[model samples]
Target chain A: MTLIVWTYIVYIALSVPLTVWVAHTLHQNGRVFLIDSFHHNEQLADSVNHLLVVGFYLINIGYVALALKEGIAPADLRQVLETISRKIGVVMLVLGAMHFFNIFLFSRMRRRALLQRVPPPVPPQAHVPVATQ
Target chain B: MNHLYVLFDAQCELCVRCRNWLAKQPTFVPLSFIALQSTKAERRFPGIDALKPSEQLLVISNEGSVYRGAHAWIMCLWALQNYREYAQRLAHPILLPFARIVCELLSRNRFFLSRALFKQEAQSVARLLAAHCRPPQTLCSNSRASV
Candidate 1:
């Protein structure tokens, strides 16, 4: 077969499993944070988690497929390896970026939830001044 | 803008150091520091006894809410950039009593701890103040003749 065909095969073979592994890891680890962020609403947290994982898969798989077309078709095995490495590197960076973005969103949500639960510190009586004789 | 006012004992070296540390933290909400003995603190929070300032750490929110001891410490942490998780964990039911006990222990012995651990920092602050107050030679000589 041609180098282009091999490149597609190698890319898909490597990318799909990597994407699945990362999504699974994020789903597992992020559940606790999401639960806390949603104020211990387990159903809401689980639904959000499932939605995030689905979105992650769609974005990453779509990117991998779109990015499979090389600028220059590889003529030799060395060229093929170099192109694959470059594509994989970009995919890895995109995955990392997505992970951090999700974390940032969840952290902000958690902070807001915490603020909501915190009781107001001062009583109305404390604001009143006493008359001095 | 919401603000958290931290009332600290200015005389305690550790308290001063802690204030400096808290000042450096990235905060979600602005934090204002006031010495419990300061006239400003007295004016802002009337009827609180300032004589025993080291007894508890007090944090007053902009909404007029007051948090004391461990709760005040947790509020301070919650206001910090990345320490919110720790604040949440400490506020948990299982850990809250422990947090309170630790806060109480620290509050009761802070003066001694300050002297033992932060004497050098206190001395440095005194030196810095002294340097600021020192008159320039030319100004001092000119003013001396006027006097």
Candidate 2:
């Protein structure tokens, strides 16, 4: 039981720093560079990050509250580790997938912007305007 | 007539939207919009290959000189005399390199964002959105140009 609790604690500890770093990157980039697309106040970004952490905490805590028994034993330790690892890994993968999907959608926009600049048709000499006249 | 021409891809929703916004800006400068996709762009500026900026924003000044990519953005900034001080500050010799770094980073994100969320078109609406003209900002105060 102690080991299971510790594993959960280690996961949370590692993710907290990583979450802050990701939020910082998002806050800085969302402003100046992608100006025309979307922007948010810096304060808002900070708030959102805080909110995300809170949400994460609530979910994980709730999960542990229900799943963690007072006496997890040495005999059952191997299965416990595997279960906890899979759950955490799946959560991380889901988060990563969401971000990747978002990025992929934006790249499609760039491609359309590129296509918008294409020429309508080739102009023939006669149909073209006579500059001097 | 002093003409500012923005050559852009018409197929891109983001580009079209940006052009529309810029056209409505109250600069009083006459602008001629050409979808580079239209032969009209080439017909207007002969001897130039139309395909070059068909995928990028091309700004052509009244002087008939063309600017592409970031330089094109610079010309637009030059025209914003009301915001000149901020523009200058952002493009300052000391600050410019950092600004470019920021610009490049933003552009990458923009490209990604457009491809991911909107899914409508490939035109990334990446912008260095200007700080608004206001008395609180130093740039607006420095502007002698008519607001």
Task: Choose the strongest candidate by DockQ.
Answer: 1
RMSD of 1: 10.7
Alpha-carbon interface RMSD for all candidates, in angstroms: 6.7, 13.3
DockQ of each: 0.10, 0.01
Error of 1 at A33 (Å): 14
lDDT (10s digit) by residue, model 1, range A1-133 = 9998898899889988999999999999999988998989999999999998999999999999898888789999999898888889999999999888888877887777776555433222233232222
Cα miss at A27, model 1 (Å)? 17
Q: Candidate 1 chain A: minimum summed lDDT over ten consecutive residues — where?
A: A122-131
Model 2 lDDT per residue over B1-147, tens place: 255677655444555566677776644245667665455555577754533664346677555667655555554554443433444465557765676566445344544444565565423321111122222334422322211
The TM-score of candidate 1 is: 0.53
Please state the CAPRI-style docking class of candidate 2.
Answer: incorrect
What is the C-alpha local distance difference test score of candidate 2?
0.48
* Recovered share of real interface contacts in candidate 1: 0.04
- Tens-place lDDT per residue, model 2, A1-133, is 4666766665566554554454455445533322322233545544544554455445544544454443443336676567557656655564465445434544543333333333211111112121221
Please give the lDDT score at residue B23 for candidate 1.
93
- Where does model 1 exceed 4 Å of error? A1-133, B50-52, B120-147
Q: Give residue B41's lDDT in candidate 2 (0 to 100).
A: 59
Highest lDDT: give the candidate number. Answer: 1
